[model samples]
Target: MMRVLLAVLFVSAGVMHFVIEPTFTAMVPPFLPAPRVLVWISGVAEIALGLATLAPRLRPYAGWGLVALLIAVFPANVYMVFDDTPAIDAPRWALWARLPIQALLVGWAIWATEATKLVRR
Candidate 1:
């Protein structure tokens, strides 16, 4: 099911934060004075998102949380394209592609959570 897939994706992406810490650190926004701290925070958020998405009672909150988180962290995505972070290992367009795809992820998370009828009362 799509919900299962989204949950798995979130889990995998959350786990990847630790696995790809250095690369994520490189994508941190220039305006942020402490890139390393932000990276860690994002990692923690991602892990929380992943876990939240898996909990039926928490899925709707997780879905909306992910949407907000994606919007909040979008600056990093922009910086990666703008600053040309070599650590990402992607083409210029690929970097640009990440932005809208993130929005799509927000939609996906919402639909997945709703389709499962997991929203708490």
Candidate 2:
């Protein structure tokens, strides 16, 4: 089920935030001017969002939470592409591809949550 998948995805990503803090820090938005605090906060937010998306009763709330979370994190992707932030060995375009890929993940979360109607007859 989509719910299960979303839950697992969130939990896994949450774990990564803590596990790979340094790599994550390296991806912070360059325009932010402060890297450490921003990276820490972003990591925390990812953990929170990942955990929040797991409960059945909270799926709707988590759905919206994910939407907000995605929007909030968009800046980091933008910074990665535009600000010359290191891509952790990824090619420049693959790094840029993250922006749209994020949208796909968000869409997957929405579908998994079934928060909105997708099929119109």
Candidate 3:
């Protein structure tokens, strides 16, 4: 199901933070203090929210959390595209693509967990 897929996506991404620590840490914007710490915290949050999405009662909250997380990390995506010396070795177009993908992920989290219904009430 789409919900399961979303959960897997997030959970896998979270695990990758630790598996590829340097890569994720590199994505942190230069302005942020303690980039490694921030990466760790966000990884844990992603894992928790991903698992929470599996519980019907928790799905809505997880959805909103994902939206917030996506927004919060957006600056890094922007930085990747614009920074003169990007930490990651990705191509410029690939980095640029991540921006819109973030939006799609937000929309997916909302739709998969039915977060909009909560907003309607």
- Count of backbone clashes, every candidate in sequence: 0, 0, 0
Question: Which ranges in model 2 have alpha carbons more than 4 Å from their true place?
Answer: 117-121
Question: What TM-score would every model get versus the actual structure?
Answer: 0.86, 0.78, 0.94
| Candidates' C-alpha lDDT | 0.79, 0.71, 0.92
Order of all candidates by lDDT, from best down to worst? Answer: 3, 1, 2
- Tens digit of lDDT per residue, candidate 3, span 1-121? 9999999999999999899999888888889999999999999999999999999999998999999999999998898888755448888898899999999999999999998878888
Local accuracy of candidate 2 as per-residue lDDT tens digits, 5-63: 77777767666766876777777765666776766666666666666667666666677
- Candidate 3's C-alpha runs over 4 A off are 84-87
Between candidates 1 and 2, the TM-score winner: 1
CA lDDT for candidate 3:
0.92
Best by lDDT: 3
Candidate 2's C-alpha lDDT? Answer: 0.71
Q: Which candidate is the best by TM-score?
A: 3
